[model samples]
Target: MKQKISLITTGGTIASKETKNGMLSSGALSGDELAALCKLPDDIEIRIVDFMKVPSMHMNFHRMLALRDAINKELEDPDVTGVVVTHGTDSLEETAYFLDIVTEDKRPIVVTGSQRSPQEVGTDVYSNLRNSIYAAANPLLENGGVVVVFNERIYSAKYVKKVHASNLQGFESFGYGYLGIIDNDVVSIYQKPLHREFFSVQNEIPRVDIIKCHTGADGLFIDASVAVGAKGIILEGVGRGQVTPQMVSSIQKALDSGTNIVITTSAEEGKVHPAYDYEGSAFDLKERGVILGADYDSKKARIKLAVLLACKNKIKSSDFKY
Candidate 1:
């Protein structure tokens, strides 16, 4: 029997087309158009779903939820083996991670995007999408949760990040590396996440913001976020998660106002640890009810926090220990 896979397209560079002005129009091509350009596997039956046509930056929580619903709808089919989502590289990691947390299905949900437009020379649009479909249908990835397939590598959504601006090798998982790779149309698996998490979120995703810390940074942004009624804030701190002393007051005030704040390190690798006693150190922040994000990039932390809040989960320090 031929393996059946659902190809859900949300647009990205892979679906972009060159405009008259010599600039690329993101998501200019439809799902069927993009799929038609690729020499997809003949052994697999592909079902194309044109969900949306927009740039990655245009993606928001509401749309993400809608995409999740659409994917889940496809999964309801018993013959469908898995799913492959073509997205823009800009926000692909966040969307992938969001699906990873909310999608409870054991079948793989593979997200992929190309850095170059499909019309460009040396574009990766064909290979990435093709590899993703194979990876999605692979039985070894059945319980591995959502994965990002790009440039032949399969990365866990939890750890993957876009590392380069325009390189074909745009996505990377940093310290953790990739789960496996697809070579010559063959899907190979070397590892899988030991644990998976799913949150059943029925409500709208709450407002979540990410604030980057720098030298002499103050609490103004934090206060503003709180004033705007943000449900969660991710603090991208430096070194072992240390913010400027001036920012601590605003962070504390936000906490007082019931804003869930997670402190994540900006470093490529390493967990946020309470290592110092300074006013804005991770230790001090944790003492004041801040959650330490365990090696999660700020964007991923923001996605998780928003999902957790949407699920009405009580924010806790231990919540980030995935």
Candidate 2:
């Protein structure tokens, strides 16, 4: 039986081209153009849908909701075995995480994009697009949640990180490593994410921001964020999620003011532990009622916070399942 895959194009470097003025212009290619860039098996059917033409940096909450709607609509069709979304790398992780948290269906939703533009030499678009299709088509990927395939590495949507500037293998999932990889036309599974659930957006755009703590960094940013009425804040603390004295006081104040504060480690991998020497900054902040962000990076943490804030009234800490 032939497997049908819907290739949803949200413009990124993969679909961008250099204009006469040498500026990178996006959405220059149609779905048919992208379909022709890859080689596929005869038993696999491909359909393309252009969801947006903006770069990943331009991606926001509203666009994410629209993409979710598109995927949900396609999932309704029995023939659509899987979905592939080509998005810009800048915000690929954010979009992937959003989909993983919101969408309930297990049908493989693989998001991928090229590090190098299609016009550049040794572009990775063809292979990434090909492997994403394979990953999406494989039945093993079912119920695995959102998966991102780029530069021969497959990452769990919730754990993946874009660490490098312009490298082909830029996407990585720090301590957890990759969930699996696609090799020899085979999609193999190594590990599964510990948590998974479906969250509802409900059209509310919640404001969540991240505050990175460094030496001599005052609480000005934190105050500004709160002043602008941020519902949630993710504090990217030092190693093992430690903040300075000043920042700690700011976080404590934020929490006291009824704002949700999630503390996450700036380390590439590992979850935040409140047990490590709480006598100083760590202990003070923990006492102030800040929630630990676990292993989520600042970017993913922001998305998780935003999604949670959107469902704030309808969800509680225990019911805050994601």
Candidate 3:
């Protein structure tokens, strides 16, 4: 009764190569090619599925929905013990968490990417790919939701973030560390992220944007987003969800126009708080109908907002709990 691991390849640094100008995720390395370089154990079967050939930076909400659909389709096969996605590191955390929110089956779905291109000296691609498959195959992770694997650490997608720009060590789970670590092809489990509700991937993807607060920031971006028909916006306010006084009116206008807002802080470690009393403080924003981003960074907040908005058909738009 041998089981298989569905290896889905979505182009990223793991499949990139060097060019005359610079490095690009040309996707020359398919899943089969990349897996061929790995010294896989004979106990598990690996099945390659080439889904897309685009860099991670090019990923969007629509593609994420499509990716979720593809993974869900594979889960229909009982023989598929687990799944691995080779992606680019740029937006790997976002994609991982989005899938985490939408995937319901709970069998381990692990995403991995390399900081350096596959052609680089000492590229981390091989180890990342191998570990991803190992993590996916491990029965202990059968219900672990979605996670990112790199540098031997297993990070829950909800808590993970890219900590370094160009390090082989791609991400960290912030205050939560990692769910577990894998050593010598062995995975040890200690804990899992605080579980959140998993929404079914919806039929249509919507426009959700993140607007960062800067000095003298006007609410112009919010106005612009609303003007362009954005379904939701994640306001990355200055520390503790504080925005300038000038931006409050813009935020209000967007809210009045029926655009949902989630307030997030620039600080990395804490949840958005309504501590200050100023015009654009989280307190003020909440009073004006903005949702507080609980421990979610701007990117993650945006992802959640999109999911809730996209699945509005089944989940009443007004009854969005998160």
Q: Which stretch of 10 consecutive residues in model 1 shows the poorest summed lDDT?
A: 312-321
lDDT of 1: 0.93
* Candidate 3 residue spans exceeding 4 A from truth: 313-322
Q: Please give the distance, in angstroms, between residue 102's alpha carbon in candidate 2 and its true position after superposition.
A: 0.4
- lDDT agreement of model 2 with the native: 0.82
TM-score of 2: 0.94
Per-residue lDDT for 1-322 in model 3, tens only?
6668998999987887678788574566777777777676567788889899888889987888789889989999988989999888889999999999898986889999888776788988878887888899988887778989998999988879998999887698777789888888788989865555688754576888999899988978888899999988988987778888999888888888788888888887877777888778889988888887867889988888888887773323233333
Give the per-residue lDDT digits (tens) of candidate 1, residues 1-322.
9999999999888999998999999998999999889999999999999999999999999899999999999999989999999999999999999999998999989999999988888999999999999998899999999999999999999999988999998988889989999999898999999989999998888899999999999999999999998999999999999999999889999988889999999999899998899899999999999999989999999999999998885887767878
- Computed on alpha carbons, the lDDT of every model, listed in order, comes to 0.93, 0.82, 0.83
Candidate number achieving the greatest lDDT relative to the actual structure: 1
**lDDT over C-alpha atoms for residue 213 of model 1:** 98
Off by over 4 Å in 1: none
Model 2 lDDT per residue over 1-322, tens place: 7899999999888888888998877656666777776675556888888778888899999999999999999999989999999999989999999999999998999999988877789999888988999899988888889999998778989888888889998888777788788886788888776667777878587898998988878789988899999988888987777887767667767777888887777888666766666632545566677776667788888888788778764323343233
Give TM-scores for every candidate, taking all chains together and pairing residue i with residue i: 0.99, 0.94, 0.94
Residue 131 alpha-carbon offset, candidate 1, angstroms: 0.6
